[model samples]
Target: MSTVGKRGASSPRELTRIKDRLSFIYLERCVVHREDNAITATDADGITHIPSATIGTLLLGPGTKVTHQAMSVLGETGAGVIWVGERGVRFYAGGRGLTRSSALVEAQAMAWANRRTRLKVARDMYRMRFPGDDPSGRTRQELLSMEGRRLKECYRRESARTGVPWRRREYSPDDFTAGDAPNQAITAAAQCMYGIAHSVVAALGCSPGLGFIHSGHERSFVLDIADLYKTDVAIPVAFDTVAESEIDVATRTRRNLRDRINSTRLLDRCVNDIKELLDHTEDDDLNDQVLLETDGDIRLDSGRNYGDELSW
Candidate 1:
């Protein structure tokens, strides 16, 4: 249910869905200027002219075009599909029926997990810094303990808000298959966590696979964040979706589930919560302060907020 833009040797323009023109996806190098009558794309020596009527979703690679008629055709069909790639517009007509509920659930769980993981990391850091000093260690320990308590309280609140019962049992590390009665809310929670972990890894400049609290393995950072999001964003969204859709475990499919998860408002709320938490938090002292604290001579754009740009 997500479109991923691959980073290649030849840098292509990032793809974006057009606002105020939901059917239209604009392609630009620096800024949007032109609209196409028809787009011709040649990849691997094969030329393809994407007709407007046939395309449900457009995926544009760098430097591509299509006609206005095509845009009009896309608008006529209310099929929600993603336009991906740089400027060369490809189409993903399938998977429109994919559900997002599971994704949302996963994202929420991840967020909660991450919150816990970060606190654990901070606690470990505090202990490492003051092993024998009981006074400072005790104070920090109390604070860490409070953070954990708050996180649990938040988890309960979020679960109540979502109307989904929290799964207290630990998932087996070996299990990967979807279970009967899939927890769509947890899936969404996990996705959110993955996003947050990526953000933290980027900000902290650490190998995402290497972690302080989460194990050092594939997608360990993602695991960490999934733990965090459960209490903060996922639960609320799950509750809202359930109320709005009036659907229960018996009727929810992957497609409707995806719809619930991809609800723009829900995503925004989740992002906002994560951003708010991060904005208020001070950088950990043990983090590479030399890299994070250095004020360099390198010129950079001043108006941009790094948090605002993070999306997966």
Candidate 2:
């Protein structure tokens, strides 16, 4: 059995139910304003009520207009808000997230900022994408090359499986019209994955630039996480979209991706995967900078006692 959430009832179960029902809320060419604890959108069609609390994410696509009040409410309620471009819902910018802890963020940063530890975490990431396989003795580069080869073979298999023409990965952000059907579908699928991935990363309070396998960009972490499911999620969706030969690849890709993400429980999986990669036990704390959250603040986890506070 499932439950539906009202305006003020967005418990964990209710939120999961919402994702099960409406994967995400896509807003475009509308003015969004606050309505009580919810939000309303007015467009050429009509007014519609949005239970922001129940939503997993609010993607602000092209032509979307949001008022300050609405933004404030969404932030306060901890909704994932993403600003996307017209081309395949490219994630351009983002707003506040729903993460309740800075401890996770600190842990991620410490893991990524270190050298030896970063390699360990990166190996764990590759291991996550390919479970039941032993890559324990292999280095990061070897694992990367292996994953690349697997992906190349996957594309070939999918091309034959779906009968969609597959040449190579071609993309140009400035010109989306230049790409062919498969290319367009690929971009559409990747962007959709990125949007969803961005929400999960943000919701975990993880920095999008601090990446294990990627570096030197603001969205490095986002790309790194999104790539983990590219072969399984985006590749299949893109190929299927191309096989359908849909005139609107983005729309069809979004539809398929929503269903896939929901079915896979990608949001929750992303959170757990991140923690698994960076998580350490009592024996292996990094840099002596271990941290924890107590009542919403990040503090050193070292078991040291500072005597009772005295007047300074």
Candidate 3:
């Protein structure tokens, strides 16, 4: 008997909420294929089954083959699928989001379209990242300067805590191994955090390019979201990972970071933070529905033809 077919595609109401799903699932050197509603990863050891709906992001690392059916199930469940290099250090592509409502993305665009609103959102983001340090009335340049100083302090603090040698942040795009062990761990942790942020952004149907603070890049908003946890989560985790063992710093950082994110329930926090930042509330009327704009900012129900003779 063939085990190919299952229930029909999941409706928006049937999809899992982004906050409830796992932060991410990483697989490498394996073949991924669908079995019923679940996906199976086959490797030299054995086959492991994973429920598609539980995954927030599926990170396909190096040496992975995904069958069409696997992708199909993943899409149906609204999981973000990202292709990355070893240990998810390099990003290449990402899958679409699971949300059927355009409320969040629309709110994001509206906020981003205004200069003052954009700056306000940026300040709010900084405030969220560093609570007790008010960003109110701070110029953008001042915010950047403050962020740089805070980061330097974070690196120093983590280094002192973990007994890892403190050094200025350094990275080489051409080579991943050029950095010291702590630097490698930090870079790896940063990349993994980016993947998690991208997953949350995609799952919530938010635009990755409409960034408030960071800009001019496809994943600008992604960077902004990821940076929120850098000082507290990523930096600390990187130092701890390197301190624990210098061997395989990148891979170790990914594992430790994943655990920390899950333990901290960062995905739930991320979804909530994005919603709060965008000032978005889910509208049941807009879920899985499309509307057309009229001349006076009226919303017309879709699927009905307005006669051409109707004037604006």
Candidate order by decreasing lDDT: 3, 2, 1
Superposition TM-score, candidate 3 onto the true structure:
0.94
lDDT of 2: 0.74
Q: How many residue pairs collide in each prediction?
A: 74, 0, 0
The predicted structure with the larger lDDT, 1 or 2, is 2
After superposition, which runs of candidate 3 have C-alpha atoms over 4 Å from their true positions?
1-7, 283-286, 308-312
Report the C-alpha lDDT of model 3 over 140-163, residue by residue, as the tens digit.
999999999998989989988889
For model 1, the stretches where C-alpha displacement exceeds 4 angstroms are 1-9, 12-148, 162-184, 191-206, 242-312
lDDT for predicted candidate 3 compared with the true structure:
0.88
Question: Which candidate number has the best lDDT?
Answer: 3
TM-score of every candidate relative to the true structure: 0.34, 0.82, 0.94
Task: Please report the TM-score between candidate 2 and the true structure.
Answer: 0.82
For candidate 3, the per-residue lDDT at 169 reads: 87
